[model samples]
Target: MRQGLGTQLRHLIDLLDGAVSAAYEEAGIDYRPRYTPVMRALEGGEPRTVSQIAEAAGITQPAATQTVTLMMKQGLLEASPGVRDARQKIVRLSAQGEALLPQLRLCWQATRAAADSLDRDMPYPLSDALAEAIAALQTQSFGARIRAARATTKSKKETS
Candidate 1:
């Protein structure tokens, strides 16, 4: 049987992330591609809450929170209470993270160039395809389509 779309998508993501991770390792950077968004968000040296970081990073709040926690443990981020709201925690890059900004910037530029090259070689660019797919899904969700298919099958079986 052909590989399912979800599985194929996940495999593609893994392949891309793995390649980037290998590049970081080869360059002597102790960073994961997953942390790139969070690092970029904090590169401006502004303290932001988890929600703000999540929005800026285009990731979920839970993912951002988890990343922040991991970065804190790795000495790449510092978390403190928000001045306006004591209960709210704000996060910013630590000195160690700031020190790696130059290297990260180079990596970011390289990654962007690589992606542009890949897009040029493809029939349809990956970013455009993904955006269109997301728009279609928003118009009619996968779950709804599956339910409709099930209903049609059930009706046909009953008629037969």
Candidate 2:
């Protein structure tokens, strides 16, 4: 059977992330591609809540929270309670994360160039397809589609 869309999407991400991770490993940098967004969000020493980071990084809240937690464990990030909202925690890049920026920036540039090269060779660029898919999903989410399919299945079963 053909692979599902989610499986294929994950495979693509794994392939890209693995290549980037391997490059970082060769350069003696302990970094993951997932760290890039969080690092970019915390650039310039700005303190932001997890939600703010999610918005800045264009990722979901849970993803930002998990990445922030992992980064903290790796000593790449620090968190403190917000001044205005004690319940809210603000996250900032650690000194170590800042120190790694120059190397990371170089890798980021190389990665972008690599991605562009990959896109150029493809008839339908992955980046463009992903962006368009996201825009379409924003209009009609996958969750809605899944629920609709489920309802159809249930209705058919009920009539039988």
The sequence of per-residue lDDT tens digits that candidate 1 reaches over residues 23-105 is 89988999989899999888988889999999999888999989998889999999889898989888999899999999989
lDDT of each: 0.92, 0.94
Task: Let me know the TM-score candidate 1 reaches against the reference structure.
Answer: 0.88
Candidate achieving the largest TM-score: 2
Candidate 2 per-residue lDDT, tens place, 1-160, comes to 9999999989998999999999999989988889899999999788999999999999999999999999999999989999998899889999999999999999999999999999999999989999999999999999998999999999999999
Please estimate how well model 1 matches the true structure, expressed as its whole-model Cα lDDT.
0.92
Q: Which stretches of candidate 2 lie over 4 Å from their true place?
A: 152-160
Ten contiguous residues with the weakest lDDT in model 2: 27-36
Clashes per candidate, residues 3 or more apart or on different chains: 0, 0
Off by over 4 Å in 1: 138-141, 144-160
Deviation (Å) of 16 in candidate 1: 0.3
